[model samples]
Structure formats: C-alpha cells, structure tokens
Target: MRLADRIAVVSTEDAVRASVSYDQLRAGDGALYWLETRPEVGGVATVTCWRPGEGARDVSPEGFDVTSGVHAYGGGAFAVIDGTLWCVGGDGLYRSRLHDDQLELVSLGSFGDLTIGDGELLAVRESEHGDDLIAVSLTGVPDIRALATCRGFLGAPRPGSGMLAWTTWSEPDMPWDRCEIWVASYSPRGQVGNPVMLAGGSEESAVEPRWGPDGALYFVSDRSGWWNLYRWDGHQVKRVAPIAGECAAEPWELGYASYDFLDDGRIVVAVQDGPRHGLVVIDPDGTVRPVDLPYTSIKPYLAVQGTTVALIGASPTAAPQVALVHLTAADPQVEVLARSEHAKLDGAQVSTPTELRVHVAGDREVIALVYPPTASAADWRAPVIVRAHPGPTASCLLRLDWQAQFFTSRGFAVVDVDYLGSTGYGRVFREALYGRWGLDDVDDCAAVADHLLATGRAVPGQVFIRGASAGGYTALHAVAQSGPFAAATAVSAIVDPDRWAETVPRFQRAHARRLRGGAGRVNAATVQRPVLLVHGTADDVAVVEDVRELADQLTAHSVPHDMLLLPDVGHYVATSTQAGTALEAELAHYRFVMTAAAAD
Candidate 1:
C-alpha cells in the first residue's frame, strides 16, 4: 500500500478498532480492573473489569469521563474498592457500583491517585492553593478528612493494611527531580499518628511506594545516580537490589506503578536501561532474575495478585495491549487480554527500529532509533524524517508508532533521536539541558541529521524534521541554526523563548530564559528554508500568541511559510482525525519543497 493508504489505515481503520490507552491496573476479589482511554470516544477514560472465566466488561457508566485534570498529564484517575470503582469525574469524585451501572457523586473536588483502605478512599485533591491528601469515608455522610498536607503537592496515595504512604514535593522541582516519601499510621476512624518522612530529600527523588506481602514498605529512589529499588525496614531504608538500571519511573503523571510485590517474597520490576527494557524478579535476598517477556515497551502501570501479573505491554510491531502473565508456570506464559488496535500488515512491511549511538559535541553520545524505509526499491536511498519527540524530557519508546510507519511505508527513513534531556538514561543525562534547553536539543537534532547523511542512510538535501510542543521549538531552532534540513514542520511550536515563558508554570520561567540565546528573531534573511506551522487555537500550554507573533515576524520578513489554526484543540491534537490531517499537510508541504528544490 502507498503512504496515504497506510496513513488512512493507521488514523482511521486501526484507531477505530483499538485506540485504547490503559492505566490504573488493579487486582482485587479474584479479578482485575483497568482504566481504558479511547481517542475514538473523544479520549474518555472508562473502567474495564475482567475475571478469569467471566470475560471483560466495562463498569463505567455511559457519557462519564473517569479521568483527572490534576496535572494536565493525568493518571491514577481511578481506584477499585471492594469491587466498586471510584474515579474523578468532571469536578467531583464518582463511585460506580460494579454489579450495576449506577454511578454516584461521592465528593465535590478534583482528585487523583485514589487509594482505598480500611473502609475509606484516600486521594490527593488539587486546588488553587496546592495539593493535599484527604480521606473520604464510604459511609456516614461521606465525611472528608485531611490525612496529610504538603506545602506544594501530594500524590501516589498508597494505603497499606494499617499504614498510609505517599510522595510529596514542592514547586521549582518536578516529581522526577526531587520528591520525599512519607508514611503514616492508618485508622478506620482517622489518621492515628503524624506522617514521618521515610526516604527522599531535596536532591533525591523517591517514588512509587507499595507495601509488600509481609507488610514492609517498598519504593524506588534515585539516590544512587540511577533509579533503583529500595525498602523501608522499620527504622531506615534498605536496598532491595542495587542494580545499575533505572526501575524508578518518571512521575510525569500521578497514577504510575512500576513494580509490585507477589505473595511470595519476590518483587517484579520494570527497568529502563538506555533504549531497551527488562522485566525482572527480585527475591527477598536481593537476587535478580530476568523474565523473558516478548514486549519491548512496558508502561509503568503494573498489578500483581499471587502469581498473576497484569500490565499494559507493547512490542515493536504491536500496539499497546493489556496483557496478563502467569508467573507460576514453569515457563512464564503471557496471554493477550485486550489490544488497542490490530493493524493487519505483513511482518516484512513493518520497519523494525535499529538503535544507534551517535557521537555529538563534548564527546557525548545521544541515542537514536532509526527505521529504514520499508519499500520495494532498495538501490536508492530514502529521504529521512528526523522526528524530535515532545517532553524534551521524554524518550521515544521502542513501540509501533503508526505515524512513523506512515512515512516509512512511503520510502522515507525515520530517525527518532533521544537527545540530551531525555529520561531512561540516568539523572545526569536528563539534567544535561538544565541551563541549556533549546540550544542543546537543537544541536542534537542537527547532529543526528548530519550523522545520517554522512552514513548514506539518508538522502542528502532531502532531510526533513517534524516536532510538537518542546520538540517543535527544537525543530524551528534547528532549521535556523543549520543547513541540513530542506524544510521543517512544527505543531504548537514555541518560536520565542521569552514569549513562551508566560505560558509555562511559574517554576519553569527561569529555565525558559536559558532557552533565550544568541539566536535572535527569525527573518527572511536568517531562515532561508520554507516552514510549516500548525497550532491549535485553544492551545493553553504554548499559547496561540506565540504562534501569532512568529507569524507576524515571518510576514514582516516576507519569509515563505504556511500556518494552520485548528479550532477547539488544546496543546495536543488528541483525536486521530486532527493528527491525520496534520500528517497529510506536513507530507504535502515536504513534497512541494522537494519538487521546488529538484526544479532548481
């Protein structure tokens, strides 16, 4: 099939069939419950319940959004309590009766990381002042009591048998940067004692607290340069296993669980080592054994009940799926429970990514996932699309992104660079962009483009770049800094760092100024290549004014460019329809630029 056909299949056909984003995986009452968000349904989060023999069923009511806007990047939106599901809906907490579809609003507040224990549900409620952990009773007027209050934020409310554990951090520091783990005695009536800081400090980031089968507290901390597993043994914190891999996940959103304790003294963990991932079992004695799993990408959401492990897993060729593994079997057996989408394509047509370590400035190495064009023609080199991922802090996982396939199927080599500020590498690599945000990322993108052209993996003078949000800013900055890319496309691009500062949180304002460098305003003379800019009119992250100001600058300089203002969309174009349109427009613009270059 052609590129357009592949795009259509990915955007409509496959998306309609699957389009699932699962999280909040919980096991209780000999069953499992998970939250599934579907873009086809306008990205509404729904709770799905599954029994060993009864099959899966949706417990969420129709027209209800079981999600939280606590951190914008929402997670830990729902909690399953005694077979009943409690979720954050709109501006209130809603509880759903599992047997029937009846839903009731339990409380009036925005909540996340809902934890249930001792006949009560605990959550971190977000408000204008800050975030606090509060307990909502299941009965008796449904009284809400403040369990723990932090000066800045509180989340990951994990209520154990008789103890309550949560993570706290103040502003100027994201959760991944630095967070403290606190534990308190729990009582059915109310909190019994004061919460004590167990592990973590201003320099250390401790997250994902859970109680073992033996009632011991376990968590992941980055005190050893890499995020590793640790346990709080009564008085002090002890290491479960001091492996050099990062088991602690970045808390970009609230409800993430990376590791879980089995009834046996074994703990199953998902570790991020560079671009690859592994699933390992850590015994009580700190012995680690790697479990052979077929999936390449495993989400932080994990749940374990006895010998069963349930997770959201994906491979290089498969979309994200809800999978269950039987750990007790002589050979661990994996069963596919639910899939987001099943794209029917031949194995040969799918391009498997090859991880590359490209050398950059200061003798540093940046990783890039390269996908060769999956086309019949082999003698000719394909034009490359260097896609800089968003989050500047986030790395592109080794999973099947149909959007990348849309270009690869059309005989284009795609390279996703994990530049300097990306996670999954240790804290040092993530902190590489501490004072230099846009410049370092911009250089890394151009460096990868240069490496690809030098190696003849990409066609010269035909390299194109695409990005969104932070990545968009890098794309625009890279194009102006270098002469490698023939054209570039940026969606919700941050063109001016100074103007962009106003849109971000108060804590990031200083870091935003560092992005303002020697690169002055882009004009017709400075930027010679054609550019395409797409911005959602309702984008609140990098406000519309940033794009309008850049458009005005481009117009004043008479630079060749195209801009599209999408209505009602926010910082991200959530729907597949909008994404497909943006992809088509980007490809069309690239073709026009290539044709003009060829004619010249």
Candidate 2:
C-alpha cells in the first residue's frame, strides 16, 4: 500500500505533540483535587495540592520537595493525610503542613514514615539497624511506640480501626518478596497483640495488603505465575479471582504491579485489559465485572480515604493522567482532577500499535510496536524512532508516550521495540537478556528496523534511535555497529562499562554482562551515528562520568555529537524543565539529519 492514504507527513501545526505538555500536579484530594509530581530535582519527587473551592491554582504555584533536598535519595514514596503530605525526605521522614509549605522533621528523631491509621496518624518507620512501627498523632507529634517488634520494616500501614493488620518481609526481597501478613489489635496508646500470622507466602513476594471493610485481608500475589488476587479470611489464602491469560499492569516499582481493595465483598482492582486497562470489581462468588471507565487505555488504581480512587492512567493518543473517582459513593463519574497540562498540550496521533514478530537469535519472538507517521507520505519518506529500553530487564509497554508522538507528529514513524531481554512477556523472555543482552536485543532492534524498512514503513536512510539509560546505550551501540539511523540520542545512559561498574547502583553493577558478553569492554567504536548525550551533573546513580566518558569516546572516534549536561540532575532527569526541551531539540536534530539524508 502506498503511504498517500496515511495522514502522516502533512506539514501542519495539528500534527504536533504540543497537545500535552505536562502538568505540575498541584494537589490531589479525593483524587479529584490534587497535583502529582515525578521529580522535583535530580533525585527528588514532590506533589502539589490545593484547598477546596479556591482550587489547586490558589494553593501554591510551586511543588514541595518531599525528599527535602537529599540529593542521594530519589524522592518517590509518599502519603497524604488531613490535607498535608508526608513522605520519606532525604534520610528521614518529613511532613509538609505549614502555610508556607515548609518541611519539618516530625519523627522522634530518625526518618521512617507517617500514615493515617485508625482515625489518627501513625508513623511506620525503618532504621538501618532494624524496623520499628511507631504511632503518630496528627493532632501533634505522634507518640513513638514500637509495634511488638517488627523484623525488616513495616509495609505501608493498612488503614484500619479496632483490629489492625500489616505486612513485613526480610531484606533483598523488598516489599513484594515473600511477606508475612500480621493481624493484631491497636490502640492510640500504641499497644499490640501476639499477632496471628494469617498467611506467610514466600519470603520474597506479597504486597498491597488491603484490610477490607468486610473484615478480610486482600493482597496481590504472583504464586500463580500471574500476579493475581489472594484473600486471607482469617485462615487459608484463597484465590478470590482466577484472573488468567492477562495481567493488569507490569511492576513499575515495589508497589506498582496492582492495587486493589475490598469493597462490598467484591475485590476492586486495576488490571491489564487489552491495549488498556481499568477498575475491575470481582465478587467472592467469582464474578469479574468491570467498573465502567470514562476513558480508554486508563483506569483508577489505589483507593484512599475509603471513597476516592487514585488513577494512574492514559489515553490512546496522550500521556498518562492521574485522575480521581469516588468509588465508595454513588454516581461514579470520573472527576478530572489533576492532569499533566503537557498531556493536554501534546497532540497524540492515534495509530493502533500491534505486536510484530521479527524473530531472530533465540526462541523468543522479538516484539516491536509501530506507530505510523502522522502525515501523508506522498510528499516524503519517513523516519523511524527505534528505542532500546533500559533494564535490558525493563519491559516496554504500549502505553502513551508524548516523546514518541512528538517525533511522529514531526513526520517520523516510531517503533518501541522490546528486545529479547525485556519483561512483561514472562521470566523465559526476561531471562534471555541474562547471557545475551547487547547481542540479542541489538540483533532484535536491528531486525525490527530492517523489517520496518523492508516493509516500507520507514525510509532505509532515515531510521533513528533514542533511549534513556540502558536504552540509550542500545541506541548508541546499535547505531555504532550497524543499521542506518540518521542519528541517535542517549539520556542518563551507561556508556562506559568500567565507569558504570564503579558508580552505578550496586544491584545494577552486573551491567557488564550486556557490554562484555560476560568478559571485557564492548567498544562504542561500532557506533558512527551522530550522538547527543544528556546527563545531570548531580546524578549519583548513573553518575555524570558515565556520559562524560561516552562524549570523550565519541569525540575520539570523530563522531558528530552534542552533549547536554544538566547542573543538578540525576538518573531520570526528573523535574528538570530542560528535559522536554532537550527532547524536542533531539527531534529537531533528527529532522535536520533525515531531511539532509533525503536531499542527498
């Protein structure tokens, strides 16, 4: 088929991704009125909030750093109480409750955690020596009382009254590892019971423990291969819903896989639906019914305040937007509370992404989803954005990405190719990266690009690569070795194996497996494409030196390159205004190269 029928390549303003820019979430109350922030600095995360009636606008024009400027720690885990937000800031826990939104250390001494428990607030904390569960009163500084002696650390406090329940697990496993679900009684006086263990699965994997209004404990477990719902009704761990053949969402972090609650004897959860997902309520009798959603490719996740459902969601042509819905009450109209103004400003051209099987190198079918260029191709051939996701362990999903559409709007087709090592497809596929990495994924990416070019979706000379961290490495290394991309960009990437081995997080130190094929340095000499490198000087994770070495190597190789070094940025370049602009600049550079290539 000719590219004429395609709406892409049209030289018009409507084909731009400016429809969604990004919103500095002000505040999120009832998921209706709230602001959500990812990064306030190099290693910081913050959220915005506003008082009712006046609106999120009047509250504050700025986001409060929940991490309290601790540069080493990347801010993430947070909880909201009474109108103020409490989170792990820096080394300790801090709360933002002042009119000026100044952060104050609210613990007895060290930083642990503070959460609303049994009508008041309680601090569930962790120290290097061990874990201690403390009780905090929102009326004043919470009285610190140890919870009968915790082992590793207390899980996010299960909000409850009368009888209280919480989960705890040992180290290395994190929270999702095998955990022990404990149920005991609590008093404002901070007393506990002998605590009967309801269900202690593996020592490495149980989380999102929701003590229901029905007096039952609900949590998601992966014991069944798929992370499904498990119920502890004071006895055996029963399978409430045998949800199979699909997953709701892949794990983004410790508590990201799935969040659900027990409302009306029904287990309400957010799960992976086809192409998109949403809130699904499952009855104890085994009937799975979906709560009608207001949008597509999106759904509400966690339930807070017993009534409000917090949503981490997306649209077919837009980025994920955090919205709120009142599920505990009648009339479940999704209230559009907080939005990434960028999501609204960015123009997303909906091109259905289907999985491609460009199988090579191994048993796994290499996956690549193509988003056709958003213009009429009659005038010119198009470019393709080939992305190699980080993690080599990280799984790339088909969710909304403003960055991808940003290029598609600029007359470039995009393919988010999940090389052999990516997750979501299961352990078999994920483990493929173990011994393979650089070789298999690179082969898969190159093959996908070849497949797209051979099939005519991309001009052979115009394929380009862009990735963050490890993905950036893939992009750079691939363009270096083979394939014809006009250019490539690597962000916060691990370019030097030896330097990265020295600085990257100890857990990720195994990165050499991908570069050396389990042995020596994998030279960037294979790359000849013009490369743009982005990194934050403040980065403690990937380290500034990683990209610096890449820049040096690129220069030594005589490769065309431009480097953007952020002053106080870290791994993800979070909360930096320059991030989006820098991304846009990368797109512009791609255009310049591809246009030139086309001219030639």
Task: Please name the candidate that would achieve the greatest TM-score relative to the true structure.
Answer: 1
Q: Please give the lDDT score at residue 187 for candidate 1.
A: 69
Top candidate by lDDT = 1
- Per-model TM-score, in order, reads 0.93, 0.79
Expressed as tens digits, the lDDT of each residue in 447-512 for candidate 2 is 888887777777877788878877776777677675656688888776656666666643234334
State the C-alpha lDDT per candidate: 0.77, 0.58
Off by over 4 Å in 1: 1-19, 99-102, 343-348, 376-380, 505-525, 574-577
Residue 506's C-alpha lDDT in candidate 1? 43
Candidate 1: count of backbone clashes, pairs at least 3 residues apart or interchain: 1
**Model 1 residue 49 lDDT?**
88
Where is model 2 poorest over a 10-residue stretch in terms of lDDT? Answer: 68-77
